[model samples]
Target: MVDHRQRRDELIDVVWRLIVEDGLAGITIRRVAERSGWSSGAVRHYLPTREAILDAAAQRVAELIEERIKAVDASAPPLDALVAVLAAVLPTDEQIQRASLVWLAFVGQAASDAGLADAQGILYRDLNQLLVELLTMLAAMGFQVDGGPASAAVELQAMLDGLTVHVLLGRVDADAAQEVLRAAVNRLLTRPPEADG
Candidate 1:
């Protein structure tokens, strides 16, 4: 007999494939059941409502991203570790590009759905916290974070977000994106505040 948890995972996998292949509008209980070779009722047994399925999918995506970041070597320098985290978030290749597409789709959907928006808020807050921690570490490493690290971290996070969107839209290649990010990091690390005359 198949494990229930396994079945649920299969459903989530099917949902992700459907989202990647057919876009967000393609995820229905009937479609998922057909794709997963399960009955409609069986799929519903795992995810009773469309919203529930979407919520589960969003959470699964977040978990996968977190897992990828967790696998990076943290013993590296803080800037290097932060770059690893940023690279993990970028669409550097096919696998990551697909994941980025799925994430973007969910983000668009979340704009209109209150429940999804709330779920997205949680993910965003977690990512922001991670960025803040990295920036704090960089400050400890002698990087000048003028006016405190939090504001600088927020600015860096915005830059990263803009870079990811550019990568996803094919406006920037991975190498160019990396160069741009490195330049931004260097400037942030080296630029000094204007001194009074």
Candidate 2:
């Protein structure tokens, strides 16, 4: 007998692949089952609705991203840690690039779909919290943030998001993106008031 967990994971994998290939519009019970070599009934047994499957896929992607960020070495300096976190978010290779494509598809689908929108909100909040934590650490390390921790966190998060979009759209290469981020961090960390004196 096939393990239910394994079967569910297979379904999610199939859904992710479909999303990468054809966006959210490409995912349906029959299509996913066909891609995974599972029966439609089996797919339905695991995910009774399209929304459920999408929510599962989104959650899985979030978990994978969190896992990647967590794998970075926390013992490094705050600047190094921040760079590592940003690097994890960027699609530097083929596997991560595919994941990024799936994420873009999910975001577009979530914009008009109320159910998926809620999941997207949760993921955004979680990611923002992670960024806030990183920003707070930077502040502790004497970074001269223009505003309070919360504001700095939001700004840095926005910058990272913009960079991700540019990189994914081919407007910026990975090396150029890294340099931009590094320059921004350097500017953020430099003590302007001290330099003025």
Best-fitting candidate, scored by lDDT: 2
- Candidate 2 is scored at a TM of 0.86
User: Which ten residues in a row are the worst by lDDT in model 1?
Assistant: 188-197
Residue pairs of candidate 1 with colliding backbone atoms: none
- Give lDDT tens digits, candidate 1, residues 50-102: 87788788777677778778988888755667677866767777766766777
lDDT for position 115 in model 1:
80
When summed lDDT is taken over every stretch of 10 residues in candidate 2, the lowest stretch is 188-197
TM-score of each: 0.84, 0.86
Q: Which parts of model 2 are misplaced by more than 4 Å?
A: 190-197
**Candidate 1 — what's its lDDT?**
0.76
